[model samples]
Target: MSAALVWFRRDLRDHDHAALYHALKAHTQVYCAFVFDRAILDALPSRRDRRVEFIHASLIELDAALRARGGGLIVRHADAREAIPPLALELGASAVYANHDYEPAALARDDAVRGALGAAGLAFHTFKDQVIFEKSEVLTGAGKPFSVFTPYRNAWRKALTPFHLKAYPVERYAAHLAAPPAASIPSLAELGFAPSNLAELKLPCGMRGARQLFDDFRQRIADYGRARDFPAVKGVSYLSIHLRFGTISIRELARFAQEQANEGAEVWLNELIWRDFYQQVLWYRPDVVTQSFRSEYDAVQWEEGEAAERLFAAWCEARTGYPIVDAAMRQLNQTGWMHNRLRMVVASFLTKDLGIHWLRGERYFADTLNDYDLAANNGGWQWAASTGCDAQPWFRIFNPVTQSQRFDAQGRFIRRYLPELADLPDKLIHEPWLMSAIDQSAYRCTLGRDYPKPIVDHAAARERTLARFKAVRPTGD
Candidate 1:
């Protein structure tokens, strides 16, 4: 009987899975596997990374789900390029199946795996699972990949059909899910990692967790448009980590949003489209992984040496003295997640306000965020830095104080993360440094000692950032 091996990567779910569906349909017997690829893991600076913990937890659920369906995930801790070929050979499989990964390194690894599998006379099949549309699927009238989001979003909506939102019914061929010998999944200690505060954070893991968050979000989705901007309010869908790890299918989420057809639903659906747009950007311009998308902006100089390092360190540790930015950083440090509005606010503050490079901020986010994806993270940092295609204009800089007063208007979100400012009035919470010595003593928090003083003067930084961008910006830009 012909056999197939299904390789699970970011997409961890059992139902509505594209590769598993195709593999089970074409082969009489099929086995599933997941690799804790060392190539990716070894380079991580922290073994206690929450993302690793989250993935490990999700995999346990994935394994149990597959076991119920007469199959089990063959978990491994080797380089995927080396592990997959031998596993396929051992299982006597004629083919290997997986979902697409658009990151440059991932693409390179896939190419190597394909070559190895081809040499062994086995087929390596991949399908689009994580995204609704991939690569150049949704392009312009001239067949060029879209660099701007709005036009791309319009074209994406125009091209959407029921076919695109359809889920792959993997259960239909579950009879072909061949049972494998019981393989032990390595513990966190065995994998050279330590425990994290994931459980304490109460982040749901695996398919079940994703569903729980989704169900809650659906109820408040009508208010999502207005409430999402307010960090203290639970207005946003906390499904990003699930989406990043593929515990939930994009098709499922997009379909629900499309069906809702409310104002909030439309706005939420646009965010998903933005995700697809960023993925396509990465596919078309792989150089964006290391360099700016708009090449000319590469010449823009960023602050460096001792002063910049101090500023960056302050930013990372949530001691930047800007309440909103500090609270956002603290939230990420503590929970491995941050509010979407705060993400923009912090990124803008990092690049435009601090006169620091966007790549620095991007790297920090990549290292810190639990839901970090290369495409979206890179796109966001570039947009804030004004160095990407169709990015925010260079002249526009975010005022961190204004953002704090606007979003965390009552400073409730700020006070949640910055307890030292809890006693300060809402009017002064956004700018504690402006408070008089008597007021600071009354509040029992002193700037530069208890919390921190504003790192940079916003107006001065704004002028400097404008001049810095103008140095590299093309004529008439």
Candidate 2:
């Protein structure tokens, strides 16, 4: 009957989906399915994970969307490497279709699935749906993959055409979609998870939620350039979670950014290009998953022993005594999202100020962020550590007080998470430790009692960090 199975992964939405579109176009009967892969879910540190909850909520919407179009999602909760091939065979499908995933672990899973499907005489097909430009799509003048972002972004801009931004017209072949089953999706408990605060958080789920956020952000996109850096303002698009999960398409976002022709939109578009940049890096140098991108940076001696462990615990618990860093960590713990600006600040504080390793912070973010994409998160931590392509300079440390004053001045964002420091005047909020003992008594806040004192002085730490990096700096530069 020329049947094909469409396997949904990170791209959860129904419309304009690359694999679904292609599957429908080529088959007389196309069935869609989503597996809550146990390999990923079981490895999570907490069962109350917001990302898992987000995916669960999104699948409900996706299932409904497909049902409305004469198809529904075949939901399964199992190891995908063991589940997909048999399911495709049971459905009498000759091929399995999916979108590409670039993470080395994900790539390995795909390879396993492909091999199993091939042994069963079923072809496995994958398409590029996540990014507009993938590995080798945009390159240097000599056709080498770009290590630096600016030149790559310029090339990405020059390579952009209307075709790349065009959506896949899935509606064209919807008639071929097979009818859906009449079963409801599994509950959170059924999936071995507890209810998360995902609904309470402003981070919406599913295609409808994605559209809502995008529509609102569209109205304010002109202000994005000046507004994104400030955590207190609603200046940036809160659509990152949507972008990470493919509830919204990259083409749609990029297309709008290109049309705006404004500085704000252009800057946002560059950020989108950065997604592709990291993706290609992961594709080319999977070794970066462990080793530093610049091998020289790997030679530096990171702080070790009980003291380093204590520092990491404080950073994780939001007890760093640096207001901005602690506030940012608080935000990440309470909610699964952090502001991009704060992400950089916290990463800098963790690696540079505390002199801990970047991998530890990267792993922490991997467990925490609702929109955690491997490529972006890894690239970001590496950038902050100054050990990645086009990373921040190793000597350039972020002063936690300065970052707080600059981005959260007036203490609006800091107050939101660290309410204990709420009573301090805006002038004293960024560095409350600066207050005299009498002033602390007056404000009803104490330095060491109410709030922990700064664990390491930023100035002293900066000098030590410089010396550590200097020991490993390449001879020429």
Candidate 3:
């Protein structure tokens, strides 16, 4: 081909990028472009979106990197499906390349783009870049998609090879990069978004940011296994947003994990594998986006009507009366992120204790989380609700107090987010309702006064949840 266009979607980096590498290697003149799709941006619930701000900052870096290497990014704010083909035609490119996006909506968008490209006598090529293994790359002995995580993890590990971990060597074909026509990258305001707390949260953006986070985490990976569960501790890598945006290469991180022999690295590697596992699940069963993975569990009725609305609002607004749950929700509300362990705790409390539908909580997370990945979020919510493949057993519901007492033993995380309960003794912090009037007054915290009472009795809620699931439980294996 004389010329080719590379469309940047989730894969934003210049180096080790599959589509970019292919475009540069295959053609004499290569152009790169990213469209801030209106179809997506116009539907966002808020103007001050951290995700958009992060992307804007990242694009500025990406444009700089590309410019330094004899290429530049072409930016546009339009419907991508309506823009990509015409942009390719206007550039007189023979082909358009992009990394695969497995989300159903993305797949549909890509399909539309492909049809348009084909009609214009142009080729559209996509490669697996975001994930290590995709589609049927890893499967069960019966040639079926592995629904359970353990066996899938084992299979994913066994299937690993050096080739899968190797970079695409994009710099090798830097000669093919064509300089862009004069045009500057768009500002966040120009793109119809306001700046969010992403910078105040100290989250670096783009390739440099990803590198910063990975380097810091490399030093702490050895301790991840033991310390990751405590929300008060900085035990986990904050590279999730980086990974979500493709600012870092999956191959690079997985290779680093594979080289490390420590238990913490092993656990972290397992998390990466889980990421791949969820991606594959999303690919094979896009229906999981709307329905339960195990359909039988769908029969279990969730809380409804005004009472359900009140409970859900309490959960979202961080006044659930459970210190840990409220604290977790508060963290999510204030920061665009939540601790991994707290995600499970709060999700369990919403679905099990309050009996609200998982989708309600799932949609809330989708809106708020900076790393709001559909596959992982849906998989997690379903797991919490005991409605997913290899999910937590319905009867084995989480007791909010016990989880709080264990995970936040000193109530450090709780106090950080719920300052009203800051003076409560650690023993009583997890359950302030247990404090007597004198103790509550002495602590400067009064139940239903300083803080709301527990929204639902854990024991009672647990029994009700068990009964709900039991009604739909398939008899005998």
Candidate 4:
């Protein structure tokens, strides 16, 4: 009987998994394995990374799930390129199956693994599972990848069929799941990582965790459109981390959104479409990871030297003296999660207000965010910087105070993250430094001592930003 090995990557769950289902159907014996690739782990800056902890927890659940199905995952802790081929040889597997990973580094790694497996007389097969439509599956009428989002989203919707959203029934071939020798899933310490605040934050992990979050989100999804923008409110799915790790399937989320048919569901579905859009963008233009999508924008000058370093440090530490910006940064530092509106606000503040390079912020987010997907994070930073496809106009700078006033009008979100400014009235909460000395005394909030004064004048920064971006503007206007 033929044997196949299913290498688990981002798609971690057992159900509705494309590679697993395909392997089960085609091979008489199907084996599952996961590699804690050192190539990725060793590059991480922190040993207390939440993503690593979350993955560790998810893998435990995955192992248990596979065991219940009369099989167990072969866990490894080597570079995937070296680990996968040898494992296939040891198992005498004829094929190695896995889901697609579109990032350039991952693509290169997959190519190497494929080559090694081919040389060893094993077929390497990959399926599109992480996204609903990937890699030119939904393209423009001219058969080119669409750079614009709205049209691409429209095309994605048009191309959607029942078959596209259908779940793979791996259980139909459960008999083929081979019972492998028991292996212990590694702990955080075993992986040379320390415990993170992920447990304290109480964000769920694994398929069970994904289900819990989705069940809660389903009830509130009808209000998502209006409530999602407010950081104080519980409106968003909180499933982004799940999506990034593939603990939950995209098809499951999209199908639910479509069936709901409310304004909130539709808006949320639009978000899923945006995820697809960014994926395809990365697939088509890999250079965007480092360079601006529009080459002209690369000419824009950013702040540098000691002053720029100080500004970035302030932004990272939530001491920029702008309540919303500080609050957002603090949220990221404390929880590894930031509200979507605040993400845009802080990104614009970084690239436009501070005159810092977007790549710097992108790298910071990649290091910090629990849901950090390279394409989405890069696309978002570049979009905020007005250097990406279909980006916001450079002239449209976000006013931090106004954004705070609008989104967190009552100062609920700001107070949650920046308690130093909590006693300030709503009028001054968005701009705590604006309060008079007498008012500050009355509120028990001192600008320099309790919090900080605005690092730079907003009006002055606006003019400087306008001038800075003008250098990269198209010749005519």
Q: How accurate is candidate 3 locally (lDDT)?
A: 0.93
TM-score of 1: 0.99
Backbone clash numbers for all candidates listed: 0, 0, 0, 0
Q: In candidate 2, how many Å is residue 228 off?
A: 0.3
Scored by Cα lDDT, where does model 4 land?
A: 0.93
Q: Stretches of candidate 4 above 4 Å error?
A: none
Global lDDT scores for all candidate models: 0.94, 0.92, 0.93, 0.93
- TM-score of structure candidate 4: 0.99
TM-score of each: 0.99, 0.99, 0.99, 0.99
Measured with C-alpha atoms, the lDDT of residue 69 in candidate 4 is: 92
lDDT of 1 by residue, 384-468 (tens): 8899977999999989999988888899999999999999999899989889999999999988899999989999999999999
Which residue pairs collide in model 1, if any? none
Q: Who wins the lDDT comparison?
A: 1
Model 4, C-alpha of 439: deviation from truth (Å): 1.6
lDDT of 4 at 176: 92
**Model 2, 224-317: lDDT tens per residue?**
9999999989998988899888999999999999999789999999999999999999899998888799989999899999999999999999
Off by over 4 Å in 3: none
